[model samples]
Target: MTLSDETPGGAGMHVHRLLDEAFAGVEMGPDQQDLKEEMRGNLVARVTELTATGMAEPAAARRALDELGDVRAILDATESRPGPGEAAWQPPRVRPNPAFAVRTVVLSAVAATGLLVLVLAATVVDVPLAAQIVAVAFVALAAGAITADALRQETTTNHPVPPARAAGYGTATLLATTGLGAAWLYLRDAGLPWLVAGALLVVASAVLFTYLGATQTNRHKAWVLRQQAPYGSDRFTEDPAAAARFGIYTVTVWLVAAAAFVALTLTAGWEWSWLAVVGGFVAMTVLIARMLFAPKA
Candidate 1:
């Protein structure tokens, strides 16, 4: 069957259309329906495999159908199989372990709480240097542990990241947290040395992150990719007006931020000018979330 020039959905829709055509003239009872669904799953699986190997979605779907051969022959062979109400073989689903999930949650909460307490103490009260250092290390460890543990666990839609890469990510997070803590110390008049160290740590983490991101390969499962195919890469494709508005808003925000930055740099000093840039970034992010991802009324 010929695929439409533009199926709203991606590879999954293509396979679905092909499946519908294949079953068009066939009679389907509950058993047949079950078999059809099973077949659909298998077909989608094959398509996913093909796409991952660099084939286009339509080509992958076509190849999967070609490989599938005669659908009726399989049905005929399976006539004596158990009915839908009985037990049937199905694909195995991968899920995160319950223990892992709980551990991740606990560690994340611990990290968050530690960071919050540290921030509050630094600002609201005088925390001793020894206590602050211990707190920083505790929070860093928690954040790193959570990052590594979470990445190593297989999820429903994505494969577990490689251990080495996961460790690298964890290290980056640890360094970033430590850097932030050092910055806090500097803000509290700990020393200029704290500021220099914080800047170095932050820069190191940023470089590591850049390297990791550049070399990262796709970890998304085939099924997830298929599901996402329909939407394509651009979230705003379906709303040209929204896209235009976002562009306008972003330009406006940055323009205002640039003016503010200049004004702050001249009057308030460069130390405070960076806040304007940070605020601009936050505003842009909020605009994106609201404009593109907000639920339709």
Candidate 2:
């Protein structure tokens, strides 16, 4: 059937017209319905955004139409099985790369063990009792928050970074926290050794979490690149330096918050520390926003 016949219902008439203009010589038929639907959905989403940005309805529609180029070419490049007969075709399966999963599990386990030992040691040691207690609590809370946030992202969004990784990190954090709490209550008499062990565990957990976050960010960038590559568009190019800066800023904010927690613990005690922590968190959020929306060269 001809293009006009295939698009008979005019369900996406504007989109069809734009595609016809962009791909003047290409054939269109029922085989292309899926591609057309996908394009229409994406364009509508963009149009919604443009409307929010103060564009008039007609202007937004035109802009959305203009951005979608050479529809048949796009469909040909993006769809592996484009014909009507193969509409439900599935791609051949490939084994997943196991390195990231292996690393995540192994690092998480080691970090948890180290954090447990460190927390136990801190409790036993003759160091600043209040400071050590505060440090342990601070680490526990931060780790828990990170794990929670990661889990939320996994469940609530379409982002990369497998749910398995988030679960692994969360498990490690919980294990370390449990170990520390148990040692503090039961092995109180072991003194410095337990404190040292607990301290080590905390540090190890931090390192593991950091590695996981970095790996996750990399995975996300790779996904973005793959999505953009097929469109011959560089609108979302992965900038390693920019990503590195984002990471640095994130870590710095966390460190500052941790420091503020420790400071309040020492001076004003646990209850007061919450205020400083909250303030630090707000500052961290602002810093992250600035980094994300900074002018690009």
Strongest candidate by lDDT: 1
lDDT of 2 by residue, 136-159 (tens): 555565555456445534221134
The residue-level lDDT of candidate 2 at 115 comes to 56
True-structure lDDT of candidate 1: 0.77
RMSD (Å) per prediction? 11.3, 14.5
lDDT of each: 0.77, 0.57
Which residue window of length 10 is worst by lDDT in model 2? 1-10
TM-score of each predicted structure versus truth:
0.50, 0.31
TM-score, predicted candidate 1 vs. hidden true structure: 0.50
The segments of candidate 2 whose C-alpha lies over 4 angstroms from its true place after superposition are 1-237
Q: Supply candidate 1's per-residue lDDT for 87.
A: 32
